[model samples]
Target: MNSMQNYLADTVKSIPPSGIRRFFDLVTQTKGVISLGVGEPDFVTPWHIREACFYALEKGYTMYTSNSGLLELREEIANYMKKKIGVEYSPQREILITIGVSEAVDLALRALLNPGDEVLVPEPSFVSYAPGTVLAYGKAVSVPTYFEDEYRLKPEVLEKYITPRSKILILAYPNNPTGGIMEKEDLEKLRDLIIKNDLIVISDEIYAELTYNGGHVSIASLPGMRDRTIVLNGFSKAYAMTGWRIGYACGHPDIIAAMTKIHQYTIMCAPIMSQMAAIEALRHGESEMRRMVDDYNNRRKIILSGFKEIGLDCFEPKGAFYAFPSIKISGMSSEEFCEKLLMEEKVAVVPGNAFGANGEGHIRCCYAASIKNIEIAIERMGNFLARHRKG
Candidate 1:
């Protein structure tokens, strides 16, 4: 035991396993558990994109691509970002293809952080931000965003967390777990704050395409922010290409160069076939992406209404596929409520506390499931709540 402890690096050993994956794994062990725990898109990759990959493979395009990925795909990504989000990045120096948003995020942290550097993170949000910062030998300072604020990070709250050592601000919108997004006005607040603090920003926009009603805005598109922000985006959520493991980051040439150095040594390049498919997704997959988003919007309506019918206080999620609702009425901690709900009703939702301490007394339900499944889960939840309240 002593020998094993000595061999393991304390940095790696000190980090805890992902809390979201813990409950997700538990659901897999149980029979007939209706899982709304994972933030995965239920839709499969668009057929044309898959077909393109197959064509690439049959044509013997299996060799490794340039470490920065195929030039053609990066061009398409730049064009897509320009037309869609109003941001322009150089395909040559500012864009680097990655294994996925996960790898892009890790690369961003690794490329930027120095020992004891502070990264300001907004929560309850994605589970990976803080851990990635810690692994890079930086401190993650959580800036709490509340349900009352629609989970949007405010300048006031953010100002309190900034310090002399602060080096980065990690922002993800159309945020995961909470589905909260920062509107243009909301971003203006932080934009001023970022310039004032002179902080680099790691903006994760993986769920940008899943936004409903309102469109997703890129912080990189804001005035004077392009050079200082590393924008991480992927085809997973929007194009239903999660299994393909493809994503990319766009930033200033120096930062992109730094990230690519790590990517080249570690990943070599994203799979050649996946890169081919992503090009198709970027050029011709807009309609398919819209169709999936529309379906999700319908399902979102059903889930939000069902929660209301069950007497839960659910904040209307404007973007992403999650619905975060308070379970305070059940008089149980989020973990207890989720476990009992799964054990009794066979429905699996994530305990909100898994996201952060501010997420306590709540639970996250992914609405990416089929409408029938969502309806059934909500019905079972109603019964579970009724029973628990009576006791």
Candidate 2:
């Protein structure tokens, strides 16, 4: 018999736990540690949304949903996308609700990738894109983003990486860690490139609704892009329903059908009660989202300004709740900075290199934390840097 470890799938062996998980683990062990590491929202799921799920359970709607998702939920998601972001989706054949945006990302890679297919992923973004590509036996080509560019994907950088093997582009905007959003024209350049290059796009847009800037203009909303773009979004960031494990992928009918086929064998369906709750969240939870977005925007300003005053090159994060700040002034490696910040200051943030090779000299701090906590973390960071600054 093969050894216990060797029997695991090669893909399983290739991945690490997560960049942010280790910091939290250390925080758990340390006394008085306050974490700003994880990108999860600090707010609780709205009571009405939770009540809907509980009501479904009380009604015994606990069975497996349709493999794609509940029809009502899919319909609501379609309408929600249209009304909220101007992206029209057909409920019938365009949406497949998976676990979370994480699962949606995985399905997109698996359904489209043959081994060795290269996926160009914008860096210092979400942790999942490259790992999901790796799990699918595809190559995740990391295209680094610099502080000067505010971590937005440059079309020229993407063009430099396109090879015969390059088959997919993973675009994440209103991005994670960096809080960078590619506006309408930025997305258009990518769309033009994809059209000319015959490339498919997997857009992980879980942070869609959390934009401090007015409205989210989806890459999938751009002309000629929807047909080739698999848009990944979920109730996690926007609805504060991370634990619900509910998310959806929308694209052309053929891609949706293929993803549904894979999900059928893997998950069968998401939880019916969660589906019911998600349906309510989409249909009747507009005000809940609005309130949360406003709160997050207020907290965002506090965190960005705090980081700037502390003398970190805090990229003005436009979307999502995290700030990516350079730590070069301290002259410590990203890992060293995080380790020492946790050990000395009892504050936690993830090292940039943890996200990618280009993440050197930087760290990710989540402002999804409470304002008080962000203030405290920022103060601790300032003290730590002040004490460590070399002549």
Give the C-alpha miss distance for residue 356 in model 2, angstroms: 0.8
**lDDT tens string, model 2, 239-348?**
99999999999899999998989999988999898889898898788898889888888988998899889998777889888888889999899999999999999999
User: Which lDDT tens digits does candidate 1 get at residues 262-366?
Assistant: 998888999999999999999899999999999999999999999999999999999989999999999999999999999999999999988878889889999
Which residue segments of model 1 deviate by more than 4 Å? Answer: 1-3
CA-lDDT, candidates in order: 0.93, 0.87
TM-score: which candidate is best?
1
TM-score of 1: 0.98
Whole-model alpha-carbon lDDT for candidate 2: 0.87
Stretches of model 2 off by over 4 angstroms after superposition: 1-3
